[model samples]
Target chain A: MGPLVPQEIIGADWNLFIAFAIGIGFGFVLEQAGFSSSRKLAGMFYGYDTVVLKVFFTGAITAMLGLLFFSLFGWIDLNLIYVNPTFLGSAIVGGVIMGAGFIIGGFCPGTSVCAAAIGKIDAMIFIGGIFLGIFFFAEGYPLLKDFYMSGSMGPLKVSDVFGISGGVLALIVIITAIVMFKLGELAEKRWPREEY
Target chain B: MKTKYMNPYLAGVLLGLVLLMAFFFSGRGLGASGAVKSVVVAAVDVVAPEHTANSGYYSKYVGEGKSPMKAWLVFEMIGVLVGGFLSGAFSGRLKWKVEHFPGITANRRLIFAGMGGILFGFGSQLGRGCTSGSALTGMASLSVAGFVSMMVIFGTAFALAFFLRKNWI
Candidate 1:
């Protein structure tokens, strides 16, 4: 009933069309959540605005719980879902570099696209930068082959790493998010900003 | 601002619902960088067919009756563009301007934006995903890579935010 594409519940071409629709939903939510602004995004780090934290955690947990329930109701087969594979060294290294980019550039790959759609010049440039970066990596693939393939730990779950069930882990994350949300409010109140 | 945006919590819930829909339907979460990678692959193929085939990275994405642009992520990205445009129109934020702090010049903002994009782009490829692909989607699936990527990205930003404080707050 679920994972319509993988299960052939939808045809190949139709799967792509569904992907487009899903993408629209994703982008619409991102912009509505004020994710199109670099300043608003960067503010999460400054304690000025923590909308990123609130929306991001809320979205993640919501989906996590949704999957749990969907599987429980026998609507979706959890095993068929695509899990992002773990490449330990690369994930940490790549994320650290991206973090630097987020603070300095103020827009990530996804957010910049939304911002660019609304005619944000900086976002346009950011998109260009992404192109250049990918090009550079592609050309330098020979040099990066080793590091990129290092720490290949195949699709492993965080819960598996921590010796817990997905439900238990999801609950733990929800609780942590609640605590963080409260702290985020305090931080924002303590240090308010006039800009959006 | 005469009007305000949606409530953060509500937006989060709606966003989560969207993510849930993605999983329920496609068995995959949202992504942005993968689409761009397809574009790059397609561009290289068009520019140098022989070179694309010869390259280690480019060849994998090109050839065998495949158009790099014909990927799920690519189509999804098109939807993202439309959705973003619609949302901006609805919110009256569809203006052409360079957004920057009063403290920084437009040129400075664009420069930093490009530089940051370059880093993010490279990292996404190396990390095999971006904020949406690796962090948000990964975390929801309870993947260890997702947690590690999320923590590292945010933690690194938190550590560097003070040094770059002049740019935002």
Candidate 2:
């Protein structure tokens, strides 16, 4: 009943338009939360600020719960919604590389774009670097293709792996986020410094 | 000294709603890296059409019926730029400056930012997504890829935090 594109409720042209609108909201929220600042984003690791953790986990949990309820009420068909397939080796390795990038670059792809929008010269350079990195990956694809597609575990869900329902997993995530929020607050207090 | 940020929880709810709307209307969740990939492909095609056609990876995104800029992610990314600009303007955070720590020079910070971006770009290709695409949106769909990406991205950052302490703290 939902996922208008896959269900053919919306045309491809409209899908592109919708992507733009969604991106606006996504960027607005990110900027409002101070995600445009590398210092603020990096603060998540140093305990000077926990806005990243708070916003990130809260957003994740809210989306998880929303999907669960939407499915329960038949507002949207969960099956039609795309689930990212897991490629275990690449996922872990890529994530690790991204992690290093996060600490070093102090911005992710989305946030970096946001930062650049606000006139951060560094953000612009970072974006340039992304292009170069991607170009490098493409040129070297033959050498890395095997590992890139390795450890295919299909599109398994976290709930499926844990032998639980999606709803239950959502609950666990919400609870866990709350606990982490508390710890984040404590950490900030213990390591208070000038605001980033 | 400045406008306070929206409550994190409220911001989260709003973000989630935005994400939900994305799935409902587009049949897919949010993404960021894909936009960059589109740009990369387009650049390669423009500069070296023959090379792009010859390469397996570049060819996939080029050739007949393909305008790399026509992708949904590209439009979305354009919107992100607009939205960010608007938000910054309204919040009075719109300023032309290089953001960095007092301990570091702007040049140094920018260099690191570039290096970091290169790493993230390469990593996103390998990982199949960046934070927004793989970690956040993936987690929303309950995909293991989402959780693993989230864990490793954050875990590695935390592990390397000490080494990069001079950059931030």
Candidate 3:
């Protein structure tokens, strides 16, 4: 009923096709959300614009809730879905590096690709940088192999860590997001700078 | 010129719905860096099959009876390009231009963009996914990795935002 490819509900060929369609939606929403602009994205940190926080948290919460509901309705098998494995040390280290890249480059891989499509030089550069970065990692894999594989916590969920239900966690996230949204709006007003 | 953006909450809802559909239909979330990895693997496989086969990092992706480019992420990335183009066109943002801060030259911006990209690329591999795959989709599943990655990414960016203030602010 769910996870078409993994469960053999859909053929391999259709998997990529579905991925393409999902990607279209992902790209469309990203652009519409003003994710195509580096200045707009960077504003999240400067307190000038909180669009990043608003959209990001909203999206995360929305999906979290959706998954919970889907599971309850038996519409999708949450267990069938892929969960990114946690390698604590690498996750933190990689995330930190990417954060620096985000602020400095002004785009993540997805946003960079979307921006590149709309003729953004910065985005294109970011994409190029991503390739170079991957290439560098490939070439120097030996040097970072140990750290990359360190801190294996297996695949675990935040809910599991807290010994709470997914629904409860989702509820908590929604409430936190609401509070943050209010604060974000306040920060924007307090800082109020020119739009990029 | 007026810059228009969709309502944040609405857009977020729409994005969430899309993510939900992804799970319902494919039992997976969205991704971006994986596509690039496919491209890298394919390119390396074509140019230096032996090298890719011998390498610990590249060999895992390149194998017999398979084309690296034929992965799910790659096709989705192609879709992302088309969808982004359509959205930009409809929104009147499909113009060809270099976006940068006034303080920096276009060349400087491009240079940093490339450098930043390189760092992001490397980081994504180490981190196991990029923003879309790791943070957004990961968080949706309530995966600890996802939350941790999200914190690292945003926290690091916030920490460094002051130093790079001129680049954006």
Candidate 4:
């Protein structure tokens, strides 16, 4: 009954409007969580501030549980939702490159956009770099095509792999999040930093 | 009047609800990089139509009666910019400044920021998503790609943190 757009419950005309509305909430929450601060985001790795860890895992667990409950309640069809396809080779290698970018740039694409919106000068330049990088990737697409298309696992689920229910996995994730939050708290105290 | 951030858990819950709403209404999770990609595709299409028409990667997104700029992610990204600005205004955090480590020069920070963006943009394309699109949304759908991306991205960052200590700490 839900996933209204795909189910035809919500008209196609409203799709873009809904996307914008959802994005507003997404951006508002992110900024409120202090995601607009690159230094604060980078603080997670340094043990000075663990806000990123606390916020990120908590958000993921919340959505995972929400989806599970929605499915259980028949509010949404889990089958209808989009599942990201897995390409192991690219996933791992690409993540490594993104990780390097995260440490070096201090902001991911989403966070960088938000930071730029708030008038962070470095974020603006970072966005320019993103455009250039994408341009290069497109121009060189012929060469990287094979590696990019390799190892297509086709939307594999962790639950399917573990032979467990989504709920069970979500419960484990919740427990893991709690433990991580504890570590995060400890780290914040162990290495407090004056405001940057 | 600079206000403090909301509690992390509370903000996270709100973010989660937004994500849930996305799935409930659209059958897809939130994304950030895809919007950027759409822009890139649109730009390439305008600059060199024949090149985009011939290129395998760019061809998928461009064609007759279709405008990549009119995509859902693009609208969402515009909203992100507006929402971010509104929040920043409300919290008095809106300022034109370069934020960086006290130890690093602002110019050096900008240079790194640009380099980092380049790498992230390229990587997101290869990986099929960035933090929001791949890691968060994928995990929400219980996909292996989501978990793996989350782990590897964070792991690599942690591993490289030592070498980049001068930049952040």
Which tens-of-lDDT digit does each residue in B1-169 have in candidate 1? 2226678888899989988988888889988999999999998888899999999999898888878998989998898888898999998899999999999899989999999999999999998899999999999888888898899999999999889988886
**Candidate 4, clashing residue pairs?**
none
Largest DockQ belongs to which candidate? Answer: 2
- In terms of docking quality, model 1 is high
Q: What is the lDDT of residue B74 in candidate 1?
A: 94
lDDT of each: 0.90, 0.91, 0.88, 0.90
- Report the C-alpha displacement of residue B93, candidate 3, in angstroms: 0.9
For residues B1-169, could you state the per-residue lDDT of candidate 2 as single tens digits? 2336777778888888888899888878888999999999998888899999999798888888988989989999999999999999998888888899999999999999999999999999999999999999999999999999999999999999999999997
Error of model 3, residue B44, in angstroms: 1.6
Decreasing DockQ order of the candidates: 2, 1, 4, 3
Going through the candidates in the order shown, the clash numbers are: 0, 0, 3, 0
Please report how far candidate 3 places residue A112 from its true position, in Å.
Answer: 0.5
| CAPRI level of candidate 2 | high
Per-residue error for A159 in candidate 1, Å, reads 1.0
**Tens digits of lDDT, candidate 4, A1-196:** 8899999999989999999999888888888889998899999899998888988888888899999998999999999999999999999999999898899899999888888889999988888878887887888889998999999999899999999999899989889889999998889889977664
- State each model's TM-score restricted to chain B: 0.96, 0.97, 0.96, 0.97
Residue ranges of candidate 2 with Cα displaced over 4 Å = B1-3
Q: Could you tell me the lDDT of residue A91 within candidate 1?
A: 93
